[model samples]
Target: MLRLSQFIFKETRERLGTLSFLINSIKFVTLAVFRILKGLFMNGTKVFNKEKIMQQNNTYVLIMAGGVGSRFWPKSRNHFPKQFIDILGTGQSLLQMTYARFLQICPKENIYILSNQDYKGLVMAQLDGIAASNILLEPSRNNTAPCIAYATYKILQQNPEANIVVAPSDHLILKETAFLDKITQALEYTSKNEALLTLGISPTRPDTGYGYIHFEQEAVAGVHEVNRFMEKPVLKKAKEYLASGDYLWNAGIFIWSAKSIQKAFQTHAPEIAKLFEQGNSVYNTSEELGFIQENYPNSPNISIDYAILEKATNVFTIPADIGWSDLGTWASLHEVLPKDASNNSKSTDHLHLEATSNCIIHLPSGKAAVIKGLDDFIIVDDEKVLLIYPKSSEQEIKSVAGAMVATYGKEYL
Candidate 1:
């Protein structure tokens, strides 16, 4: 081992003699040896899978992945939504990434997925080791209120004192350590208090796509009371909210105790509460399917924000700078991805381009593409359908997808 280490240092120093180069070379060699040792001793287990804090078996995760992601059409289809796709070019899909992120907080068996019944096969194929029963299948896409109601009620049956974190399967969080730290903090707070907490991202821009959250100036235990929830506003209103310094981009990530949220539903969304309450005995049993199928659609179609958080006085916000993105549209994806000198982001290296700037291109592997004289545009070529549209008007892609479904067929979408 000493001989091998000396040989590496000698070769590195001979090739690059500068002081900085020698330091970097030593660091690289050290990292390589460390990785080898860790692989041998640890058997490739991840850093976050430690047993220290994950013993909080009362902590649970509910990943909401029911949306169609229509704005990212051609790539994100109805049958194959964004959550099941590796839109970031990462090996793991978004749903897999989300599940892995929560392994630091809770045990594998503690995690659950809230998704439409149609994506059952896709969800199972993407996420390994999750219980088939843990995948709470929604009979219909009744939005988030019904979705949360079912999961909250169901988890209550298994563990009446569970504290849960609800996150979207498709959102991207770049700063994992900080994000997890915030999650740990939120879980700590929720385990103790009756407050309903949402992780609010500090806005980097006046983004009009996301809903804005108005919060109080004071904080208790690093969380502030939410004054109100604002709808997606116009450009002028978004800019005003950004300038105010009292607003955050509502990230839709929520944290609460099972008992706290259950009570909120009973008080604010009584109908939804009563509807899901009937499944108390059947939540974790063989009768869950029959119970949900018959009763889920009867609940009102509403968002948790509108139904509970907006009305509940216990709503709180954790202002976090976690480098988050909803990845809602092609424009949003472009901003998060790496760009070239010309500011063009491409998923495939097979693209030949000239004078093309401020564009996002995604193509299947090994598919060569050549383009010229394009600016501020989205170019996505899924094997079946290709889309080329202006980045400024990317919001219209949802309507365009609906048009395609109307003209051609659902198969194309």
Candidate 2:
């Protein structure tokens, strides 16, 4: 009996020891996994959690569609801006494409378009199923500062902890996966810190048309501190900037918390901040239009860069190589559109050209045209109006459009 009891006791002890080892092994593996997950999320290497990272419930998007796109005229008119047209020939308007891109970042209800009150119908027609309230109409053309303030403050009222991505409606992004990743990175950083972050496109050329962002060696999780902002530079300065390697083209894509941006406005431009604050009570309500109509235009006319981004001390930028183009000019549009071996972009096959190189021809579908001996030109035919101008003189197109409006009538425009 004593031997049998010893045998049983030894067997029980060995089983307990094996069980202990298994538990310890499990605990070690779990700890390692937890740390790995924490590191991945902290470094922005991976997205976790449904609310913050996966579904992005707290993320909101603001699409700036108020611009008249005067540079793209005869094709882009005051009544019907370029944002509403299928400039890319992809059957999707720029506004529609922009809105669709944001949907992948946030909920459909969280998207907002800040456009002139005149374009509300166009906005609705393009973005079907979007809630009418989601369209934030600007009472007047007060530029970006006022509309941004209005939209940010209004979003704050709805979700005080909102993370907003402000983007132009007319830009084109070819590498969407890379672009979304950068936006997610910026959004993640803003969620944890009180930093105003913007994406800076790595410059591929010394182009003078884009604003440049100067960043310092200081960086946090891939975002660098912005040293200063430079407006469109001359060719010489642009080359210098490209050589320095510290400059990035300002993409105007910003990500920030509503609280953070609101604080910046309050700190830098108290008047603009106060102007929108008064309407907090009426925002998201039926009385909002009346309040905006009466008070929005009263706000100062200033760009967001001048109003807050330039003045804010906590500005940061993430250098990204995502294929981005503001599509600010016809020449810019030509660069991205599919081209032929001769370096010409034509929207329709009806256009037949001979000895033409470096030209862009846009015309209505099924409208046939034949041209010869033209190089580096823009030919656009939009019912009742035709524009054929040299690409080198495209910079003056804006003033030319205004002159046409004055000489002829707004009807032609």
Candidate 3:
């Protein structure tokens, strides 16, 4: 009886030990699975948060290159505008260079070209690497205001939170790094503040060719609150502006969010804004051409400066010393181009004799050009015709081209 009782006790002890071992193994596997799942979930959350942050920083740049550049005539014709020419001998067209500069700040898909419908092929050929859908073509030449409004509406449709930098395609910027830095700063400010921002170039001369921005006080670091906009004042007024040190050359570069610009249009130019709103449905579609052709001509021919900036209360200016030139006329081109020892600016192929002071000779092609006993003159050869005018009369070149187009056929233009 004693032996049988001992055997039963030993068997019960063995069964209990086996049960304890099975419970321990199950607990270990459950804990391991929970830890692995937690780790995977945390990593996925981190990656998703990073991607969202990157997307919020995205920006768009709209380049206005639609004008015919009638001022740079003889060389700059209707079919081939100044923006498509290699005026700086940099082996890249103006549009190409402008697009490349913005690529450093924004993605290629975010860059847009608002140009004439006629120059669509030229723009595409020059900027072939950019996506074809990004280019916005105008069916007619209404002016800057309509062009900007259309672009703003289209951009807002794509990205409601988009910030845009609108720039001209033909201007020459020497200090690219400084220019880009200034643009980035302006974008940051505009995104945060509800203001219309324009980059004003530091005035180096009392020239009457460009517009001026009058500031009452410095708003921020290197930025000023614009008091008023003065357009091409007289020589006396220009000197006074220079002496007062409260003015800057309007560089015509603007940075603002899509919402801000759209609001400005709605407030200042309601008719044009309505046109754009009605035409927005056709954007990025084959019907864009037909819609613009039908609706664009009825819009106003006002500039953004005249339509909104001049009247806006929240206008601000960033006075940038970013080495800028509009290249508006022959004299301005001479100012930016390198001069020889005799203080004369000559193109790739030119011969000068006894030309000691202040002259600009530009032959578009590398054809031999010869000049003698001339000073302060602009000589431009466009293969079909040549222009010889005084550098002092540079502002009259556009009027001269218009008169020629009227008198002769478009062949001479």
Best by lDDT: 2
TM-score of each: 0.87, 0.87, 0.84
Q: How many residue pairs clash in each candidate?
A: 0, 0, 0
Worst 10 residues of 1 by lDDT: 41-50
Please give the CA lDDT of all the candidate structures.
Answer: 0.83, 0.84, 0.78
lDDT of 2 by residue, 1-413 (tens): 22332343344448668666334422233233323333433453333233445455889889999988989998999889999988877667999988887777788888889998899999999999988998888877888999999999888989898999999999987656667888888898999999999999999999999999999867779999999999999999999999999999999999999999999999999999999999999998889889998999899999999999999999999998767889999999887564556778777666778999889898887789999999999999988789999999999999998898899999766
| Runs of candidate 3 exceeding 4 Å displacement | 1-57, 285-287, 349-352
Deviation from native of the Cα of residue 246 in model 3, angstroms: 0.7
C-alpha lDDT of residue 241 in model 3: 90
Q: Scored by Cα lDDT, where does model 2 land? A: 0.84
- Show the colliding residue pairs in model 3: none
TM-score of model number 3: 0.84
Q: Which pairs clash inside model 2?
A: none
Model 3, C-alpha of 255: deviation from truth (Å)? 0.6
Q: What is the C-alpha RMSD of each candidate to the true structure, in Å?
A: 7.8, 17.7, 24.3
TM-score of 2: 0.87
lDDT string for model 1 (92-160, tens) is 688898888887777878888999989999988888767898898889888999989999999998899
